[model samples]
Target: MCSVPLPRRALAGLALAAAAPRLTRAAAAATSLRSTEWEMRTPAGIRHRIQLGWPDALPPAGGYPAMLLLDGQTTYPMAQAVAQPPSGQEPPRDLEAALLVGLTYPEDAFDSGLGVDSRTRDYTLPGPSAPPGAGGVEAFLDFIENHLLPELASRFPLNPDRLALFGHSYGGLCALHAFFTRPALFGTTIAASPSIWWQQGVLLKEEQRFVAALPPGTSRRHLLITVGAREQRSEAELAAMEPRRRERAQSSNMVGRAAAMAERLAGLGAGAPQLEFVSFAGEDHGSVISPAMRRALRFALGR
Candidate 1:
């Protein structure tokens, strides 16, 4: 058999047969994500329902990147099933694996369990129009950096050098706050469709402060801002939003605004960290999460 030369097709077939098991294993590891439900307590005694995800079959040792996503009820499950996307949905391939932690409301409801009032209190900045219990972002960040992180460390070996935060809408706004104020806590931040218009565009002020605080020279970190193309409203739509539009000065073109934010941050010269913006065409505010999450996770995994 060694003296005989096999046909090219036969050789190719044999090579493919050898690679099949590896392909299958990779698919299995990607699709069969493992998770555990966790109940946590904030410093103020507020309860938190959380979920953690990792590839199947883990070592007893630690040393993988970790990501914390807000709106756990929504983001948690999607990320778990990332390996099996629906037809026509093209996400990135061979996504690097990491620990995915979801910070959910303490309630039983996965959808809107946190409720408008509870979320408003926990995820927003203070302003004249802010409702009662608003401006608690600092406390929320503290909970994650101090209480939640320590607890997570006890269970798994996490790579502190590449921790990340992922959030959308108001949650996205909250993620930005953490990035600006607690830059050392996480190396990457994925803010999808951040509510920059919230509280009279106050986030821009915070962004400026964040930039000003930089000690000069290229910093180490990554920030990715994402939005849907369809979320942008035309001038006519903006006209209809009048009085209110005039009041907030927040562009109805959400994607454009995000791009502007990216541009502004990128222009901060070598002293600033790397920043990128992505807008998915034909995707609206609600339809952009999957893609945004994909890119965000890739960045966190250092792909």
Candidate 2:
């Protein structure tokens, strides 16, 4: 595995800050949406919060095609609004109103730096050099598979075959992690600006290995990867940064990494999943969520 150089890490942080929009107090006040949270016990004896939103009524005969959204605190409302049928459309009529589920950790989880430590532990796969406190991904997957899915299936009219998983940033990295380790877990997965650079391209290498071992005639799963037009830095910014450092940061942009991964998957012929790459113009990393959610819903619903 390639080690992430120190200069690259510094550039990544700078790029993130440069590309991220500043959230203002006024903007926070203007946004209004009430989200409900429920505590559920994972099979591992850990309790996690799941937030949900749906139309007031259900579809006539069947349950809705549900979307399991990671990082609900930030992305849930955006997804919920995007999932709603447009005006002049009937409720549960067109695409079947989707039930949005948000996954979150305990309150104290973020006391130690934006939950990065805990997330690394829970979202990464176990390996010899898997960084200390990493590889709780399997346990987290178990929680979703054994406990969360079953409970949601029982309570709602859910289309099991159409289940979709959505994640962004670190969450997106986890979604891809799950995809390589257990592709069958979800029918369709949307990973937006995933951290392929995490642990120095371990996720990308894993995808390569997964495609190599896949059997022929396997049902092609669906994966949608998206990047923003401004995701790559301007020549001016690159010029200002250290020459050696800018190249490393450029390698990690969603466009470069996602396109490479998609091409690799496509090269696998019949065994690979159906993959799509989209570039949203005039948006940056944080602002890409709204558009990505909109595109994902349309993609999942076959609309």
Candidate 3:
């Protein structure tokens, strides 16, 4: 044994075994999700926190498609899961890789009592009966179109033509506003359980205008509107509510209104945005996000 020399094959095997763990770690790091965060103050002096994430994989020809998510604190993680599924799971077959941008507010706004106020201000349209500090959606969209998109494009390989916007609840109302007012900015728009009742169903009127004003040769767009089957309060649930709260709930009518919007757009024939309407069975407002997210990823990024 003292005089024996190891065979070349055995020596090679030892070298390979010693290097395996390092190689595995490197591979994992390369493919893992990476994010960049920063703050931007808009012209009105409101500061927003932006979080951006892109696939570790190389972008395609022009660049990666990007999605701007309102209420980023909640939706970003959901979109991230779709962009890069948890370890050992595969992403959907039709889904494409994309850059995910979370348009959120400062940490203090999120942690303190201002969260509701912030969302209300930035996600609603002005109306005769609007809430306090409401009606800042135009400014929010201005920030995204004039500032955020340009800034992100300069720093990342993003395809401007393939952009998308997503929002839920109040955020969903904002998404609908953007789709109506700035139709060309986002090629795809998804509003999950939009507060169509906002401002006395003002957006329903806006939808009518959007359809009527479609210009000839407008670029193609896609829209997906989803609502929870159980979004409308049940008879017992409504009976238990306060008088005003119950009245508000009755007016919201999330499922019916969402389907009506979809039906109207779908009836526009070839000139309107390609549309899809989905109602998740047994899901209420809060429980609908996850399943809607799956459909949203496909609607935005699917080939």
Candidate 4:
């Protein structure tokens, strides 16, 4: 049998900063929704926490569309709000019901920084000459596909064809890797501010491979890549920063790289994922999650 829903207080661990009052209210509102938590271990003996929330309404014939989030500790609550609006709030007319699932570690919180080590190990894919503590992404993907999905299916009705994957930063890098390596895993992938510069922009090559390998009759998919307008830094912001920080920011070029990726992928014609690139105005890395996730939900649900 599926586990019982955890009490509202159990979500205290997900608390965020004062700048995120919107998310704070959303988190509080989430307490009244139908939600549950599962503590599971991967085959590699690594423990993981899975947070799930579904609408109060019953499923449609095929079941609710499911979205799996990478940084559950921070992203899950916002997703819960997007998937199911708080009591008395009218949901977007075009928005359909969905199941929001967050993949995270135990004892994590949005502000804790405790989960960074685990995230580094799980969300990065590096080469043989790469730094230590990298390249666990393949094993992580195996766990998600071979172990986690089956367990999730046993507990709820998920529409097999409508599943999506979402991640930000390093998690976003991992999501792109998952798509290039296993295109059929999720129908939609929303990568917010992906660390495209990781391992010297290796994912650019991965993207080439994905497009090259696509068969003439490959199945349709959707990929949304979003970055904060301020992520690349304005001239004034760069000048104010220390030399090293400014240099790194200039080299990273997050906005340019993400936009370029979207443009290249868009040329994949009818068979590949339909690509959408969004740059949220005036938002930075830390603040873009909420808006990007809101857009992700609409994109995933075909709104």
Best by TM-score: 3
Q: Which candidate achieves the best lDDT against the true structure? A: 3
- Writing each residue's lDDT as its tens digit, candidate 3 over 65-135 gives 88888888889988887776654566556878777899898877653244347878889998998866788
Candidates 3 and 4, the one with greater lDDT: 3
Instruction: Give a tens-digit lDDT track for model 4, residues 1-303.
Output: 112121122222332221222233345444454677877888667888888776655567676678999989899988887677765677566778777899998874222233337787788887656566666788888898888776666555566777899999998999888878776678788999999888788887888887878833234777899999989988988999999989899888999999998888787666656778999999999899999998998899755
TM-scores of all predicted structures: 0.78, 0.77, 0.84, 0.83
Higher-lDDT candidate of 1 and 4: 4
Point out the higher-scoring one by lDDT: 2 or 4: 4
Say which prediction, candidate 1 or candidate 4, comes out ahead on TM-score.
Answer: 4
For every candidate, C-alpha RMSD to the true structure in Å: 12.0, 12.8, 12.7, 8.3
Error (Å) of candidate 3 at residue 270 is 2.3
| C-alpha lDDT (0 to 100) for residue 14 of candidate 4 | 38
Question: lDDT of each structure?
Answer: 0.70, 0.67, 0.78, 0.77
Query: What's the true lDDT of residue 111 in model 3?
Result: 35
- TM-score-based ranking: 3, 4, 1, 2
Give the alpha carbon lDDT tens digit for every residue of 181-224 in model 1: 77677778889999887877788888888887773323678888
TM-score of 1: 0.78
